[model samples]
Target chain A: MSPDRPTLTATPHNVGVDAAVAAARRVVTALLHAGDGSAAAMAEVASRLTAVAEHLEEHAPTRDERLVDMWAGEGVTRHDPVTGPENAVAPPLPLSGLPDGSIQGTVTLGLPYQGPPGCVHGGVSALLLDHTLGVANHWAGDSGMTGTLTLRYHRPTPLFEELTVRARQVSVEGRKIRTTGEILAGDAVCVSAEGLFVNKHLPRPR
Target chain B: MSPDRPTLTATPHNVGVDAAVAAARRVVTALLHAGDGSAAAMAEVASRLTAVAEHLEEHAPTRDERLVDMWAGEGVTRHDPVTGPENAVAPPLPLSGLPDGSIQGTVTLGLPYQGPPGCVHGGVSALLLDHTLGVANHWAGDSGMTGTLTLRYHRPTPLFEELTVRARQVSVEGRKIRTTGEILAGDAVCVSAEGLFVNKHLPRPR
Candidate 1:
């Protein structure tokens, strides 16, 4: 059901080239969680942001060139939408592999990630679990593209609270890798997922 | 298959605000796609971004208050991660209702959304279709939480190109709704999804 409508007053609002990246991420969270809600204020924030963007663009290479360069080193890991430090959209979740062969991380989401009022978007839960599953496969000494993924939502994932994400490779058969993952609000599972990955080699970037 | 990494130079960089919102979205895209990549440059951008954030904070409400205010109207639609204009993380794909009870939209993503070098992240594809399916449910005069969603990645979804997303309601059984959708690169399907939604009433904000 829709919530009560309020007249929006309107207002507005990344990383360096890690701390810079973190600061930028905060910028997004702050804007979404506590923006002025006034049009004039939003315009002012936008203008300043535009100036910053223009400055960055002034020294940056083309996107195609950047894309090629990203694969050259740590770009793939550094710019991904889930954990990439260079990506502002990512909660930038930093995943660590456990000795037990699972990958895990914790992230506290905010208004920018909301869906059903005060809760994390259902799709976002899938995104976190999917990415964590990929990392689990990597930890298990395998890399593959996701072939199929299935998810179940157990409960609403509240916003502005730390949620734990965990995943593990369940089995590997030839080129097939099966993994399971979950997003937890404390000890309660909010969403759980299962994935099948195919280990076929993808073309490398030139 | 990684690409070559050119060392990131550091760099740095929203809206009332509708215009402000668009500008802010551009800031995120520009930073992800064309950032200078140097620590120094990034630090400078971060500093500027922090200043803007602090300034916005000066006039903003608290996160809890904003959360309440959001459901009070456009906030729900305007702040969601997939379609919320206020959310920079969203590619913010806009969906339209079709004559035959379906929903559709088109968007072009770039580096911020990449998973496999030049391709759109698999999870991101799931995010898109899930949101589109929700919209489709709304169009069909039914609303429900996503009970189960199954996605099959038929092929890699390429980034930086216009991709079409479409979903339709298949059937309704008692309080259950079944829907199917896909992400397409031109005419070719990249990822297809089936979702089961339960028509349970969720609590609303006061």
Candidate 2:
């Protein structure tokens, strides 16, 4: 079977909800594309996208179990071209007993990220680092927005390789969470970053 | 004379050198357009552009005088269409013998910066903040590389406004200079930023 083929678990019926969520996502994506791309319009688009993503998560099969099974499945042994192949094979985070100050994930850079001949863009590198660091801050029990980020490029990160990003909390003072991370290409450190994430009261969902 | 017209500035004895530099810039621009845009390539292009800029400064008769002059002559008023007309007509730095903590300059934002319909791109805002913060750091007697930068967008910054950016030194610890700035559209603060700049010893050209 192709990797794209969905394997329904032995659970009770949820196909109607899943299909509805998928259809909603398609409609939202289309609406966002049709918008004039203004700030107000994009803000609305982002809101709609967030709502669709949340609904999809609620209606879909157990994400962790499905991801683990997919990892072991032959159809998903390799990376997927879209939604990211490396990301598709990524091991799901076990929510049972989460750690205090560590986060780990793997991502594959694709053709959409060509900055140099075959290397990733610096800005893209910054984006990934910021995201992983933010996750780490959240995991460390200090959920916050990125207040500051400092990146040092040791060398060019080659595309198509499975990059491992790990972040850990250094300390937390007042509302700021200090964290550091490194992107490793195999055993070599391709980029290093230090960031200060500031905790802010999240707006209540309307 | 049209503001875009390139006038003879005291008639440099070697006009051939200026022509050669212009030709080189054209060739470089063409080569950049042909290559896979990478961070390394962008850095290389930035370096080459800096070289051309420095060459022009060296050959221009009133370049040094204009550097200190608050109101520069019309020679430096032409807008570069590539980077956008926002960069055109950069005002000269007015370095009066006051204290060591003064930040001042005026820049125009134009249509080329339309990332979100009528607003500037987020990255472009960061770039402008970085550049302004770099100058502020230099003025504060701590010329250094950006160690960390944090920006908070309170509201979307509109394009084609005479935005005023003001930076002030919050504190200094050892070699790190901490400063904060805000981009004001009219009386409202559109974006606020804080940055940590580090001073590293480097060989200066004679």
Candidate 3:
């Protein structure tokens, strides 16, 4: 059974949704990177964004209905927090499947994802790896819920620089699947992760 | 030496920035929840948000300047991805220090952080635990970079619900600080984590 769930997939939309999400992310990044400490200006921007929210609310479907639509068509692909084009919080990593049964992508994070000084947050790296590993599983024709994840931070992942992320399945035994993944700043591996995922429909022994 | 870094701290701003971030996050949430597949409406919303971004850019300071200001005071306290008020990506967890050298917080996540059908992304849980463990270190008067993190997802952490997060220092050996944390939905622990952090001023073993 594919542990494919509805909420993780992208919803049906034209190219316009992608563009809008991209625009929203740009707004988020700019807000994080800029701010001259002007209270009046801040209020003004807030009011403008609030108006946008109100307009969207007036024209959109409820989130629950949207979730069902995503799963009905694409299964577990797209719209994920790590790679969903519709999610503004996502850097919305663009990944490709490899001939060797691996998956990899590149993303340039900015101030919005920063944690240590100019580096990416340790957990964000984990988020990327987790999703990448899931994609790797999908590439290998298997899927499961993340059961355990282990990560080692070799160095700080810098912000505003292109970073490579890759993941591949290591082994699968019945309901359990193991995968390994890493994030790289150029040639330097900044963080590496291993995850164990359990098939969602299987019964567990107590 | 406090493993305090400037990027993780919140910048000096009046209540206006806080309100602005909150509004911006609401916009993000609404965008994710609504959107009825109307391309023209989406375009209109995108244009409005783009204008807001441009207005802020015209009036705000650069990100580097903001980073410098965050570290010059308070030192590794706010503006963190897990608890920063200025960061729209943060659930902006409300955390409190405990007398027993622990830190605890509560946050109700919405669609922006979802992964599994109705559950929080496993990686998101890791993100919360990682930040909470760092808070535990801070409450214990110590701080360091995350060296290794391990997580076990006992159950799916649900979205749109108040979740309790808690962390405490388990041990400190020289430059190594070990902390444990967990995310609880009501009384059930959904995810638990252990992390090893290294002090910034100390030399790591080869």
Q: What stretches of model 3 exceed 4 Å from their correct place?
A: A1-14, A36-40, A201-206, B1-14, B36-40, B75-77, B201-206
Instruction: Go through the candidates in order and give each one's C-alpha lDDT.
Output: 0.76, 0.44, 0.77
Candidate 2 lDDT tens digits, A22-140: 22222322221121211223343234334333333343334234333333432211211111111211111111112434665566664323233345444345545655565566556
DockQ of each: 0.44, 0.03, 0.45
Predicted complex 2: DockQ: 0.03
Which 10-residue window of candidate 1 chain A scores lowest in summed lDDT? A5-14
> How would the candidate models be sorted by TM-score, starting from the highest?
1, 3, 2
Ranking by DockQ: 3, 1, 2
Per-model TM-score versus the true fold: 0.89, 0.37, 0.89
Ranking by lDDT: 3, 1, 2
For model 2, state the Cα shift of residue A31 in Å: 20
Better of 1 and 2 by TM-score: 1
What tens digits encode model 3's per-residue C-alpha lDDT throughout A68-164? 6554554444455788877788887877776677877788988777777778889888888888888788777788899999999999898889999
State the displacement of the C-alpha of residue A67, model 2, in Å, after optimal TM-score superposition.
28
lDDT of 3 by residue, B1-206 (tens): 12332123244344576777777888877777664364337777777877877777776665667777654554554556777777787887766666566777778998888887767888888888887888788778778899999999998898889999998999999999999999999999999999999977322112
Error of 1 at B2 (Å): 44
Better of 2 and 3 by DockQ: 3
Per-residue C-alpha lDDT of model 1 across residues A98-125, encoded as one tens digit per residue = 6677777788987777878688898988
> Could you tell me which 10 consecutive residues in candidate 2 chain A have the lowest summed lDDT?
A88-97
